[model samples]
Target: MSFNNGGYLETDDALRMLDLLSQASGSDFYMSLESKGKKVAGEIQTLFSDNMEVLEIGGYSYVAEVASAPGSGKGVARGLPLAVVRDCDAATASIASLLYSQDSDLIVNILVFKAGGDNADRQPFFEIELTGGRVSQHAILTGGMPKRPCEIIVFSYRAVEIKSAPQLVSGIRGAVRSAKLVNN
Candidate 1:
């Protein structure tokens, strides 16, 4: 699902997501789009594109437009696409979650998104992936735990809240595992 608004990668309502993902270093931000509609879950695979010099954001993939030709997608225009995971594997998501959920004071942008393709009757499950927006290093929380597509929330990290961060992430992992087990 793509929006028509040009240039603005983030909507006004994206403050929560921005703080949660872009400025995620110390805050728990909840995402609630202003209007009626379903929010699209971003996948890591789409964030980090392959070494093709081409960039992919959302469902759109673009590269540098020729200098002589008309304006297609360049500098800021490219960045207009929301920052999200461009590419990822199983371990990627695990490591991302751990990294984002880590106990720290310095804030960083950590994008944890799921692949929006789970069917209702097929045991709802989501695949978490790391979207390296502004953050550099990342870790894994529930490396071996399973994730439920329907039960995932994006939040920010706070200074004092860093204490129970590990346990909190563990709980999320446990819950994901439990859901997987129940589904099976």
Candidate 2:
């Protein structure tokens, strides 16, 4: 599903989350935004056009575009959206369980979200895309909003070749571990 305010994240938080994704995937990132028709989405849409230019933060680049609303439901999405409960330790445990349940070598696309303060299912979050066993793309909504999506940040990574359950577990563990550090 498209992220809600409970899943929202600020620009700085999104970038910090990117650090975790980078650590887990062992790569930098190519970042962009996909407008989901929210208020901030409009601000972003007005800032850039299809043929203008992209902005660079730290070292990575970001491009923005206006788009239709993302489809509904969890599976309407193509990636796995992970919300950490209690702490990253809990997240790691859940990731382990999820990997073990899967039965094949797969390319995992995880959208790690930091839930909203009141609840974990709101909005205002960023997303990442993983393909070909590396972090290739990231989607984020950023502006000077009054509140952030969550204390934890979303971890976006690309196609991690989980050849075995152990590898899958380790990759996600690393991502969660990095998130723990970032969260604290």
Candidate 3:
């Protein structure tokens, strides 16, 4: 698909993309968007099906701006910052792998978000000491939060010329955090 920088996808197209990712990876897909004191699931499917506006980031990531209002439905809302749905798995892994293969200064941040409490209450939970590139042995836990844990990993490489490593990491982190789940 010819994805514009900020183009929005219809629900059917989004669902199709999710289906393709699931088939390719052999796993079901889910977007975590909290609402009404709980994580909303099928609402994402419903919103997409209804052609709600979703922001496309870097072709692989998408963010749906959900309204915080209770009865507010249909098209995208104007002012309120409602909820966010992100494709927090396969696409992230692909990005990390691609960055890892390219350069040595590449730093990959794996952000694990568990269910239960709000995003704010969940602060810098813990960090793992990695001596090498592989993270296969680590079991990331978040103080027994929700059963449905979602991970959003971002990769950044230090610039050889102008930008510093911290700058690059910060920019990448901001971008990744802003991105909501659409498809893998």
Predicted structure with the largest TM-score when compared to the true one: 3
Candidate 2: where are CA atoms >4 Å away? 1-87, 103-122, 128-184
Identify the candidate with maximal lDDT: 2
Q: Rank the candidates by TM-score, best first.
A: 3, 2, 1
lDDT of 3 by residue, 28-67 (tens): 2232222123322222222222232222211123223444
| Model 1: lDDT of residue 22 | 26
Better of 1 and 2 by lDDT: 2
Error of 3 at 79 (Å): 47
lDDT of 1 by residue, 90-146 (tens): 334543554465532322222222333312212112221212222223212221122
Tell me how far the alpha carbon of residue 85 in candidate 2 is from the true structure, in angstroms, after superposition.
14
1 versus 3: better TM-score goes to: 3
lDDT of 2: 0.27
Please, what's the RMSD in Å of model 3? 21.0
